[model samples]
Target chain A: MKLTGAEILIRELIALGANKVFGYPGGSVLDIYDMLYKNATKITHYITAHEQGAVHAADGYARYSGKPGVVIATSGPGSTNLVTGIATAFLDSVPLITITGNVPTALIGKDSFQEVNIVGITMPIIKHSYSLRSACDIQRVVREAFYIATSDRPGPVLIDIPKDVQQELADYNQNFEYSMPAKTIKIDLHNAISLLLKSKRPYIYAGGGVLISGATATLLKFAEKISAPVSSSLMGVTAIPYDHDLALGMAGMHGRYAATKALYDCDLLIAIGVRFSDRATGNKDKFLRQCKVLQIDIDRAEINKNILVDEFLIGDVKEILDSILELLPENKNKSWLNHITKLKNSHENLLWTSNNSLTPKSIIESVRSVLGETPVSTDVGQHQMWTAQYYGFTKPRSFLTSGGLGTMGFGFGAAIGACVASNNQRVVLITSDGSFHMNLNELATAVTYNMPLTIILLDNNALGMVRQWQTMFYEKRYSQTALDRKTNYVLLAESFGAVGFKVMNVHELTVALTKTNKITDKPVLIHCLINQDENVFPMIPPNGTINDIIIR
Target chain B: MNSKKHPIFLLVHNHYGVLTRVAGLFANRGYNIENLSVGCTEKPSISRMTIVVDCSESLLDQLLQQLRKLIDVIAAERADPFNSVSRELMLVKITHSPESGGQLLEAINIFRGRVVDMAPESLIVEITGEEDKLNAFIRYVEKFGIIELSRTGLTILDRGQVSLITKSNNN
Candidate 1:
């Protein structure tokens, strides 16, 4: 059959099982939008207020659904706007297909209106990019884009279709075929298993790869079978239930004291799907000073990129874990477990504050208790660390935050996406005032969709994380950390036609949360004014070793 | 760390802005490209680039991996200095006074170079050889009052039938 390039692209997306596309339209993409309008019934096109929001929504959807998210935008500023969101997806390994409309083939370099070399601009960040010059290449490009975006270490792939190409006629062969390369899994577990057996204090450090490969169940079984305690990176917090006896919660800068201490004391470290990021290991030399490291990751390049490992396995985390589970005997390390328990108990009493001020910790605890298993997304900074430390994530994909890039303003669009992807499941956005102000424009998106999202705004009236750093290290020279704007968040929410509540104390917060929980039709924002002087604790200062951790 | 000069070769799709992408990758990472040469391959659709960088072995490995990860790049590998066949082209213009013309000609013949073009006061000599050999030729020509010089950086190929095309296909 013969069809326009735009029609073929839409048909290909539908064939690939993509039911939703997030985009904002422009002149260069008019033909594609026309085709999308015709096929609106088959696929829902979400028109976000900005291109960044559109891409972020797609990113959120991909993270939530474990499938490739689709996004579309026009050329020039429209395509450039997706850069941050694309980088966010790329750094975190979220699969996304970003389609941008370019100027016609002839006018690509002529400086025609809305013409930009988007493929060149995003080459470094994206997994792959294709600039289509002919209509006939659309089918193959679309297939390749989808395949590359979701295969192996997933990341964003850009496809630039010129305006003329979209309007051009192409022979659409429904039977066109492409085969994905077979994934090869090769691993030798002898050394790793032997190390695990030989050590007195063996610890398991899991990362996002566990969740990405769906190895959480296998990880839990392996941890239980080996009787080893588990600690997670920020990205891996959801890999094991927080309340599990063997789970030591998050590790690294801003990590739980017990978790960091366990890492410091362990004799053998079995790291799975972790890159040993600097933030996760304050000082690489001191992270596992006396421990033999056995690292497992799907990406071979990541094995020794940051911290050297004594033994390594390069393959899918779930498969590797399954193999490890099948190997060898059942053993117990009672003394190590006892030591961990004592350490956990000793540090347990250090997390509370004496004042009655509404804190992020208390707010996170309340939210977790009230909404068990509800997916929570957060922007970067104090609130993110607080949520990672306090929220109990019992399942994978339950907590989504920008880990690698630490992108602020990421949660708003992602929360909406999670809500949509999870079939209107109540999603929460735990964001600080500094981070929330960056993407508050997205509040209109929530109102437009009427998504069941709750915005837990932690308004400290300053860039809390940086301010804390300055206060600690720079003799309290605040600099530009303070955001003294008079923008009323409650009134802002009301302006967007959403319910708003202001809570000053724990009692008021509880009342606001209770009241907001009852209302389901519209999104609600609960503004909790936290103390400006408050800072996230158990912080390891920059370039400091894990041993140099400050408990206060 | 001992920084040794390594010649890295890449076969990429012949597309616009691919050079920018390759150069940008190095620029962004703060890796210095000491010398670079690019041209079309036997297949017009493919282009080959040779980049010489002075860095440690591990850093070189990282650069190779990053280069291979690029979308347009089909294959990337480091050319062994001892085992690989490498050559660079240099064009030098020397002062052609009657007093020095004879010495310049003798030197060019010894270096197996040719006088490609001649003007009244100068002669342009072209020499093709390894970097060290070209440097020697330039040094000898400098005594004759060289007027100008241009050199294409190293272009290398592995010894025997092992080609980048076959290597990329095998992967």
Candidate 2:
């Protein structure tokens, strides 16, 4: 059938099983918007106040569902605004597709109105990009973009369609040929098995790659077969259930005391689907030095990018775990497990603060009592680390946050995405006062959609994370960490047509949170007041390892 | 001693902005590209690039892995310097006195180079060989005023029946 490029683009997305997308409209995207309006019943398009929020919504959707999320925008500033969200997805390896409308083919390099080279602007961050010149290429390009965005080691891909191409007529068809790059994954478990046999104490360090490959079940089985305790990076916090006996929650800077100590004392480190980021490995030289490292990742580039490994396997993590599960005999390392259990018991205070005063732990504990396993997201700050430390997650993909890029304003937009993807369940956005002001304009998006979301504002009246850094590392300079604002959050939420709750203590917070459960028609902003002196502890100073850990 | 410069070959889809992706990968990763030469191969869809990057073995391993990750690239492998044949084309414009012209011509001939263009004051000598050979030819005639020099960096291929394009496994 013959159809315009804009129509074909919408049809192609629908055929690819995309029922929803997020974006903002402008001059160049008029034709695409017109087509979207006609096919509004087929595909739902949610327009956020800013393009950045839309892209982030797409990213959150992708992260929560493990599918490619589509975000569309127009030219120039509209496209440039999506850069941060695009880079965030790139850093976290989220599968996202960004479509932009450019000036017509005739005005490409002529500096026409609202013309910008979005493909060029997004080259470094995106996995790949395409600038479409012809209307006939719409179906193939859309399919190709989707394929590239969701392939191995997935990330974002950009497609820039000129205005003329969107209006041009093309013969569209459903059939298309698509093939991804041939992945050559060579796996050898011989040396890995030998190293495992010779080791007495082994630790399993899993990361987002395990969750990305949907190998969480295999990861648990593998850990059981080896009788090893598990530690997760910030990206992999929910990979293993927080309640599991062998699971010692997050391990790194703000990691639980037992997990970090195990990373140091283990004889063998079986790193699965992880990148040893600086935040994860404070000083690589001192952290992984004692262990014979066995690094397993799908991307070959990540194998020796940070640290040298004694043995490595480059393949799908699920397959690799299965192969390892088959090759090795089950060894119940009772002594090592007992040692770890003792360590976990002794250092349990590090994970919780004394609840004599109102604190993030008490507030989080109250929220968890009300909401369970609803897929929480967070903005970067002290509250994010606190939630990471306190939230008891039981499944993979249930906890979403900006682990790699650590963007401050990432929570609200991501919550909207998750809320949209998981329709009936209410999603939660945990943000600090400082991070909340970055993109609270997204409140309009949540209100307009009437999304069932709970925005838990941990109002400390200061940037607690950086303030703690200034106090510890920079001789208490304090600097610009103090932020005092006079705007009332309850009134602000009321003006946005959402429910607002002001809570000061644990009882008040629990009561306010219970009220939010009944008011599920719109978003609820729970402004929980707390002291600014609270800081994330058990921090390993930058470039400082086990010896330099500060527990206070 | 370990050599720093390594020539890596890539088979990429022939299209626009492909070079930018490859070049951006190097620049973003802090790897230096010493030289590069690329052109179409026997297949119209596939082009070949022989990029020389100066880095350690570990960085080279990372670079090769990153290059292979590019969607347009069909294959990425480092050229075997010991078994592969490489050549470069250099256009050197040199100016000399009439009496010194005879010496320059003798020097160019010894290096198996020929004059592609000539004027009253200068002549452009075209030379095609390995980088060392080109350097030697320039050294032999450096006393004469060298006006300009341009080179199409090394293009390399293995000394075997199978080529990268023919040997690439798409499956």
- The two-chain DockQ for each candidate, comma-separated, is 0.53, 0.85
**Given candidate 2, what's the lDDT at residue A413?**
85
> What are the candidates' C-alpha RMSDs?
2.0, 1.8
Retained native contacts per candidate, as fractions?
Answer: 0.47, 0.88
Model 1 misplaced stretches (Cα beyond 4 Å) = A183-185, A348-350, B42-44, B161-171
How would you encode candidate 2's per-residue C-alpha lDDT over A1-552 as one tens digit per residue? 889999999999999988899999999999999999999999999999899999999999998999899999999999999999999999999999999999999999999999999998899898999999999999988999898888789999999999999999999876766676575656668999999888889999999999999999999998888888999999999889998989988888988889998888899999998899999999877778778999988888898888889999888899998988888999888999999999888854356475545789988878888976688999997899998899888879988899999999998889989988898469989898999999999999999999989999998888889999998889989899888787699999999999888888888888898888887779999998888878887788898887888787
Q: What C-alpha lDDT, on a 0 to 100 scale, does residue A235 get in candidate 2? A: 91
lDDT of 2: 0.89
lDDT of 1: 0.87
DockQ of 1: 0.53
- The true-versus-predicted C-alpha distance at residue B74 of model 2, in Å, is 1.3
Q: Best candidate per TM-score, number? A: 2
Q: Tell me, by lDDT, which candidate is best.
A: 2
Clashes of 2: 0
